[model samples]
Target: NYFSKNPVTGKKVDWYTDFYYPLLNQWAERVRMVTSPDKLIFVEPVPNEFCPTSLAEHQPANMVFAPHWYDLNALFAKAFGDFTVNVQGLSRGMFPLKTFYWGHKGARENYTLQIRNIVEKAHDSLGERPVLLGECGVPMDMNKGEAFETGDFKWQARMMDALITALEQSLIGFTLWNYNPANDDERGDDWNGENFSWFSRGRALPPSLLYYEQDAPSLDNGGRILQSIVRPYAAKTAGIPIHFQYEMNTGTFTYTWVNSTPNPASQTYLKGEKSVFKPPRTGHPALMSLETELFLPSQLAHGRTVIVKGLDPGDKHRYDESRQTLFIVCQDASLDKVHSIVVSLDPPLAPAFAVNDFWGDFGGTITSILVAIAAIVTYFFLL
Candidate 1:
């Protein structure tokens, strides 16, 4: 039996019941006393644990369930393959036999299921409080540092894409593990041989630069797996966001949200009283004036077309190329109505060259060169 001496009562007590639980509650209470009540308190789960269900009894009003998740198989193996294990299930003693998933599609589905489970558990125990994925990222030094030697981070990009895609499918917010300027190819992050930093000082020539020479890294560049990291996302939504997905191969981004608001009497509405969208019956002009803003990366938005559906006739959309933002106003009279916006490349070419090449040229012909130059000039003029 787990036992501990209660410092306050000078008596022996059950470790988890009389000691650990009280200690955690007291610590949370103490933290709540000092910090502003309006500020969010991100309570981290115990290491290796999935959810903090123990705190359900004394959960603070501003408490947020923040948990860190990682693909243990990939993290430890330092190589991404077609197979993945159910590490979380094994940790929880759910099954004696470890579950395995095969193929890239299966692995990705497994990853997304893991995140979905975490979010669902938090919701079940915490009652609709925000669940923020505290940390999620892939190690850059995969395949025994193959990318470092060849400067081909395509594998790293794929791994990162898988991780982020899981997060996106779960419809949760996350903070990437790290961005360290001091990271290099040799020692990595300078801690326990761990190398997860997005940016690294060690310069390696990528395949794009193999044909050209450059003395310094471009101002827009520095990351290891940027193709997966630098992506389009909805910065702010006037209505409740339902779902969003980005196709890395096709340069297509789709976002959907419902034109609804929380009950006016709800705490969420009171917290953001000034910014909350009022119903049209309330005679609030801002009711139908709210606009959703989406951040579109230059590489994706340069020549893409924006299509918005389920919007009122007067409601419109605009693209600010300078800011790389797509703004859409949806004035649907029905609060239950859902609106969607899709941004896709104009030509809708094959994924292979459409996403990677700017001018969409594979041959080294003079005509291709001229087309590339004209595309560059047009891109600049639009900018």
Candidate 2:
């Protein structure tokens, strides 16, 4: 006799509306009673929704955002296609969200903006609480399982690239959707044929097609999706992240994060800064002795290809081809001051040219004397 849906506030009698909501409050209360200040309890708004404005207030003080992200195009279409591709599904016909959200902006562009917006929602609504991309990955069977048969995961790689670029640009952490050996292109994830697993011996191509492209014993088995997903990240970040990017064609990865602050909250929270007093040269949330582990396609970084500027004395770097990664360490860097770190695979070099180099080693003086004599002879003859 108590079933109801509010037309104004739109509250419903479902568990999510009543039981779960109260349960969350109860959990927060329990945390306040038992948990310490340092430990965190992560929470989400819903499957794909951003954290609501009230979420932060309702949770414990040490909670963080744990929103899930998915390339909506792939999720809706169940295929490796772009956002421009029309989304096809029953829910899409009655509701035009898929079409409208994906509107003319093309796949890569749309996803970047969309993912960025999602990240910003957490920042703006949640107030700098660390956001983790809880679950994200495109299904391998997209584009009608073309990659599985052709053994070319270019599509998967490109799609994953879009996803990774968005996450890194946002400087958020993510745990890819899954790592299920059971995902056959036929059975998928087994719950709803949702096969998003990145590793599978049954699906593994020959050693040649293996990610990292290394000869392996029976233990190691995964393909391009795994390769694309298991790339490098700042294992340790020195400061708040500003931005980072990866150039696909050049296989270049660039990362920037504020590692330190001479003053508190230099990177953000400016509204309250005027109230706080500080000393001069109390530079930004400053950073020094920054270190990053960068991934590359090949082993060694190209000659002089690793560059990190703005450190007090510049950064020290080394490349490991076996691991396909470059490790960089910087002693001093600043957020108020701009700094950059770049690692790339450069192109072949050009030959150097010098005006006198051609004859320098082969008797340059003799050649000059011969030239002078020829000039004198010509002058006399002409005269």
Candidate 3:
């Protein structure tokens, strides 16, 4: 066993400590000197970037954990088919990915467990600091976009559900892998065939589809893929999330949390309303709300509302369609009263993912066109 001399103890420590701890301290000293106090410096250890121990002195006061994850099995298959997807005999044997061990329930458990361990490590290493899943998501060309081409994205949807459930269970925030609407299939991200982008142009938007020509339909132009992967989540919270699950098969969403702070939390947003599932409703919903974006009538999908529990009946909650998030605002906003919540999605499609080093380029042209239409309507009304 290799060891190093402890800085203070004058005793021996594991070999990794000599490098990892100093790296963190050096990172902190450099980041802290240049970075604004308001902004944080997320540190990753040598090699894998997984933090194994609490960063010693010089770690920024607001440092966070940002790590990316990928399932080796899915990467090997170049598809999203996991334990939930069925693969039968003869055809299955042609590839090692379909082998019993890799495609079994145990494999899924291992995936979930790995998430748990990451969260566990962060908590132990950082003293009650925040954890953000820096990057996660799977490639799109899996099975040659079979589910996507058919408009039945349940396979990828199921995988996303498992991923979001794990994050919710761990109470961690995440950013998905990519969203290059212009992602070319042959040269994914212009590097290799690792097309984990949520939005890609593998297939054109069919007339039956809802999007326009310029619109980057999700994961090979599959609406369900976008719908499933980009649903409501608690953006800012009054407390730590304990459990959250959205069942696509049943269209149910449930979230629970324990209040950790006494001060009222700022507003919470449930983004992606323009495209997400909107429960059956008649009148223009997004137009009626201040938080929601005023989308072009054609661009606007019906907005969804949730049944709430544990919240004061008087508190204001709305699904802001424009921003693509759900908002929970309370007059009290006190942690004492709003510690826990349950949001039941009317026709939930379970859970959500990512990509894109940048999110600004994608165009929401419908929004621009809607603005023009609204102006025309106003002018006609005046005339």
Taking all chains together, each candidate's TM-score versus the true structure is 0.73, 0.67, 0.59
Residue 217's lDDT within candidate 2 is: 32
How do the candidates rank by TM-score, highest first? 1, 2, 3
lDDT of each: 0.69, 0.59, 0.52
The residue-by-residue lDDT of candidate 3 on 252-282, one tens digit each, is 5566543333222432333222111111122
TM-score leader: 1
Count of backbone collisions within predicted model 2: 12
- 2 or 3, greater by lDDT: 2
The clash count of every prediction, one per candidate, is 0, 12, 19
User: Candidate 3: which stretches are off by over 4 Å?
Assistant: 1-28, 31-38, 46-50, 57-61, 77-110, 143-154, 204-224, 261-305, 310-339, 345-383
Model 2 scores what on Cα lDDT?
0.59
Leading candidate by lDDT:
1
By the lDDT metric, which is better: model 1 or model 2? Answer: 1
